[model samples]
Target chain A: MLRQLEDRYVHGLINKSVQGFLISNHGNDAWVEIARMANLPPQGFESMLTYPDSMTDKVLDGACTYVGCTRASLMEDIGMFLVTHPDLEAVRRLMRFGGPTFEDFVLSLDEVHDRACLAVPELTLPKISLNDTGVGQYVITTQWQVVGAISLVSGVLRAMADDYGALVVLDVGPHLHSDGRIMETLSVFIAEPEFAAGRSFSLAERLA
Target chain B: MTSTVSLGFDALDGLMPMHILIDKLGVIMHAGPTAVRLRPEHDLLGMRLFDVLTCVRPACDGGFEDFRQVIGQPLKLQFRAAPHTRLRGLLHPLDDGQLLLNLSLGYSVVEAVSDYALTSRDFSHCDPTVEMLFLIEAKSAALSESKKLNARLDEAREAAQTQAETDALTGLHNRRAMDQRLCDMTQSRRRTEFGLMHLDLDFFKQVNDTHGHAAGDHVLLKVASILREETRANDLVARVGGDEFVLIFPDCTDVTLLDTIAARIIARLEEPIPFGSKQCRISASIGTTISSLYSEPDPDRMLSDADTALYQSKNAGRARHTLFKDAFEADDMVAH
Candidate 1:
């Protein structure tokens, strides 16, 4: 389970047959790989674009892609994800000339990362994740998945300069399938931010 | 035999199996086959990757196509995120024993910068770099070819979208488009006395049975074209349904003015479409209604009233226009 200020990222549990998961991290991008063996469907595949970061009310419509899976095993399937590399100058062009492309989105991602790193060099990680399966909309590409206990970087870090406070909650089990698709099953989004204004973060603690 | 976090497979070297490190949420951060040593180069440590990217909306399970577009080289997958340190993994069979995964340690970097921007002569962080320059050049070429295919697809989608709003045979605006047009007409009273003419071609289906669908189509298109040409410039012609057309004239004065226009249309359409041995006789029964500024109501009611009048015209005799207000008493009798 993972939790932050207001945003929460969750993934289904790893199945029993699956031994463990894989983890990867780049610059700030986190890519976690869950390895398992559940006779996956031989023919399975799917993919989509998720606007996890929607601070700008920007949406990529046709840019949203869908792929079908043909052959797969229960544990794994062929999946793909779209990390649009937009052109920033193109966005400025839209703001200036009147039209934009995926380049604008690509550039926007870059801007957000740069801004995060500039504000708090500790948090902003930008890497595309892949699911390699036909299920979940998110293709958990380039994640940093650690199965057992993980030692956190020992540092008294300050609150990152984020317009929206983020948080996450997840449950991992043996009855789960992983192939990068955006998850929309059982989750929660507090609310849309009024522009980039900061919202107070609150959560209920569970006591054993 | 090899050891792993999940499914175990054969070792690259007899001693060590490879490991690929990924984040806690399962995105590949780095991928490569590594030698298995009791003590590895990197160590796995972390609760989960909490970067805002993974905490995105919808939780990207996997629907998007992803590949690192390096400045140069084909878009081949360069890395998988299993674990960055002490890359350790296994090749084990799934519980179903149908498949086996050769795994590795996928590690992470505190932060990564994958996007760059470049400008001419010099480059900015946002501009395409030399590597991206090559990638974009090639990407353009590939996209150009893709555009060709997409164009055909675009046309097909457009055709499908168009078909939903059109008559199958005559290529005229179907009832759906007519409904939209009526809504639009309701918005403005810019033109006084908007007149709706609901017409049903006499014995159109008989023609279809006698001459086949082809001849009926020819006849329908001919009538529709003539109706469009004969009507006032502001009037609209639409195939509201099968063998039924509604001509809407925003300003035609009175029933007499409309009658003259309908008469001219009847005269123009008197000619038969020669289908095989026999000449198919063509005629339309018309029902008209007016939405006057002095007494206004819902546009749908006007169409309903006009449709009733059209039925009366067909009932009395084909090839004529009838006004609903003129026969409202009879309409009341039928309503009861």
Candidate 2:
């Protein structure tokens, strides 16, 4: 879909109008958060979490909205992703490779709503309900008013925390009055995840 | 007792029972354990579960059918049951005979937290999401310090790169760096080459002499900014010296496109930039050079050649572009 959009808009003139086109490159922040969460620093983090420098400048970068909220995960969440994603191949790959990868986790907003039913088990939801969006070179989204299985998500995060040492949660925030449901919630978790940015920047504070 | 299959550990069954729900009475679901003689429990089987166990959110009259699944997919229903009850719901059409529709009340369990909700770094063998911001202040601090250190590293790397090549006042690449790039180009074995150009600000000295060094700095910075805006991402540009700049067209984007780029730049500069109360008009004279990747020409020689071409551009008229090797004879000496 992103490819489709790119193809349609190659002139890139009108679109080039917006600013901040690059990824946040949040790895250093990610490394610090990992160290802080794991109680390690510099070379100390290498044993348990990862070497501080393991998170590089380019790797730290993301095609994201806010740079701060992205990074690192707990072990259990990694396991859950390995179990839950629709693509068994990806799950196997992640299990073999070790990841709380954004592509493996972040979904189209409509997909989030559809997946919510898996978590909640009883919510009737629409398929392909939300539009997938583009950022940098990727597409991610979140939706509102879908019944969520928090416990399942929590379980995934737990497994990830055990397997790795961090947990990650992503949010596009909320959309009010979407099919009459105020769609807002913290939807992602990687077991016990370290914060991406050392100093957390509250989206609420900025918006308010 | 009805023949039942053993479903692993009893402890898991306690928290998350695997029982089928039957619509006998208003009972939504039944217990996992069986009764004596393989018979279903008489007293509990048909009883409404709400009467036996309390619903935390009785008002939570939300439909379970439309829940979100996994990270972002619409959910599918899974049969859920409690350990203590024994009821099942079977929905069937005559053709299919019978379909078991097991239903269980969904709920949240409260585990006695060992520690206060803290930061993720502060959590150990604990649920990652539950540890709120509070009580993890110490870990947060350590995390912040480490983050600061990493940021410092990035800043240092950027600073080093800038120091090696940047023209300080204008924040543009220096002449030395541009020449290095060209030298690499001349030495390369690739057949395709870049178009090189030299630009000199017409009447730049007048701005410095009249408006002060601060004004001069502003104009230079503005020019650099314009060049950045007008050029493609592949292009390389530098402020080689006072009022003189270099532009490298890495790959030839057709001459028409290059002319458009040049024209757009001039048009942008033609707009009077606010220089204090008085607006300053700026324009540039340009010289162009195109060579191949296999061309083993000297970089310094190329710049000199470009400089010679720029002089003709200035001599013929400022705010215009002239090509070297094409516009001027190679033997024509450029005035020092």
Top DockQ model: 2
Instruction: Report the lDDT of model 1 for residue A136.
Output: 20
Output the chain A TM-score of model 2.
Answer: 0.23
The lowest-lDDT stretch of 10 consecutive residues in candidate 1 chain B is B109-118
What is the DockQ score, from 0 to 1, of model 2?
A: 0.02
Any idea what lDDT model 2 has? 0.45
Model 2 chain B poorest 10 in a row by lDDT: B108-117
List residue ranges in candidate 2 displaced over 4 A: A1-208, B1-158, B190-192, B253-256, B293-295, B329-336
What TM value does model 2 have? 0.34
Segments in model 1 whose C-alpha atoms lie over 4 Å from true places: A1-208, B1-161, B188-193, B232-234, B329-336
Per-residue C-alpha lDDT of model 2 across residues B1-336, encoded as one tens digit per residue:
767444443542343333334343335444444221122356446655334332222222223321101112221232123333322222221122211232232221111112112122222222222222221322343345457667877998998987988788877789778877887777757433777788888878888888888988888889989999888777888988788889988777355655666667778877877887977777888877666422466677778777887887888878887777645663344422
TM-score of model 1 (CA atoms): 0.36
lDDT of 2 at B6: 40
For A10-34, candidate 2 gives per-residue lDDT tens digits of: 1111111001111012334544444
